[model samples]
Target: MTQIDIKVASSEILEKYFIGNELPLEAPVETWINYEREEKGMDVKMKSFCHLLFYSKLGSQLFDSINLDLDGSCCLIGTTILTAVRIAVDPLTEVVYSENPDRNFLKSNNFSYGIVVVGELPYSESVGDSTNLTIAEPGYDTITNVCEYVKCVVIIMSGRPVVIEPYLPKMEALVAAWLPGTEGQGVSDVLFGDYGFTGKLARTWFKTVDQLPMNVGDPHYDPLFPFGYGLTTIPIERKATQ
Candidate 1:
């Protein structure tokens, strides 16, 4: 989350000075790029203000929970999750509960209300096109159709750009929605708004472990989707319908 904080601050700097500041940065996701410290595991260079807004909302939730507990009954929790914002996340855990008939199977389809049992803390876009992704899955030809349905092209590799040479004709815009952390809502926010998608896969999505990119200290440790790519959303006119 702190990484996001830095990105937020840097974005402010980017905004106040870059692109004349008077006008919104044009195609920011691609115009500007900043990848957070890899160790932190978050691309702090947020392409949209929506991410900033979401983090602010999280802060409000934290303050209310703690301020209302002013009875001194609550002690600030400091652990893996340093802040309530960190705790109240959308973690997708793939755990199977102990055998119990009460539950039909291992997991249920309902979402979890995210628990913030105890924690403290604080916290806290673009567009483009270019698709025609390739897919080499022989039997999964339908994936090609799926790509076309969504107007995807230039299939970004989840794992080594899936030898799409044979199926490139089916795509329009392809990207690797990396295994980002819990706050996936941030991902959705960027994808659906004024900001363009600028994220790339942090890790290689390999079909087999043997094909995984090795960290051999080579300068060209290439990724399927080379670090920066984004697009701007098309402006739309609102019309009242009868």
Candidate 2:
């Protein structure tokens, strides 16, 4: 988390004065082309912001038990949880109940209102157009197992939506923080309830890749989540300003 913090902060400074917005030092198109060609940037800042939002099966139950309200609380976030890290142990177990003391700290407070933010870091250059829509190995059961014993907020960091049907039944809350650009504080900003969750889903999340090609004339059009699928901390109808 600290590493993420540092990277994000620095990226914002760069973005403010150089990359995206109105800044005098902003690079020109020719310079931009060269920069892209070289792929020059920080990985943490490059990451799009995507975190778990709303709640799944464990929704009301979780909000009631732990203080995981739109309000805020301490939480844990895991990364790159695809394959099993230990040959003798389940990969999901490695992440959920790993030897990591931080995980243990949150688990200890499970019944007492502990909050663990956990999920996978799935990425690809282009969304649907590119292949590799799979959620990988043990990632399928990560939320189910973790939520069984701990109060957790799941985050899926990806450039595009991936299948989430299986784990939906157990997840309390999930956020889709697309590669959050170097503003790590935004993660804490939302987690701590400093600000309300205002982002929405940009793509459809399917139950499985088998239901792919979610386009016109595609026979299998059933999606776990459809396009424009999104939720906000404040109801759209009641927001101060829509």
Best by lDDT, which number?
2
lDDT of each: 0.31, 0.44
Q: Could you give candidate 2's per-residue lDDT for residues 166-190 as a string of tens digits?
A: 6666667777766664334456556
User: How does model 1 fare in lDDT?
Assistant: 0.31
- Provide TM-scores for the models: 0.26, 0.46
Model 1 lDDT at residue 137: 35
Write the residue-wise lDDT of candidate 1 on 117-232 in tens digits. Answer: 11111112012211322232331344343343434323232323343334445555444433233333444344333234545444343233343454434475553333333444
Clash number for every model? 32, 22
Lowest summed lDDT window (length 10), candidate 1: 114-123
Residue 171 accuracy (lDDT) in model 2: 63
The local lDDT score (0 to 100) that residue 178 gets in candidate 1 is 32
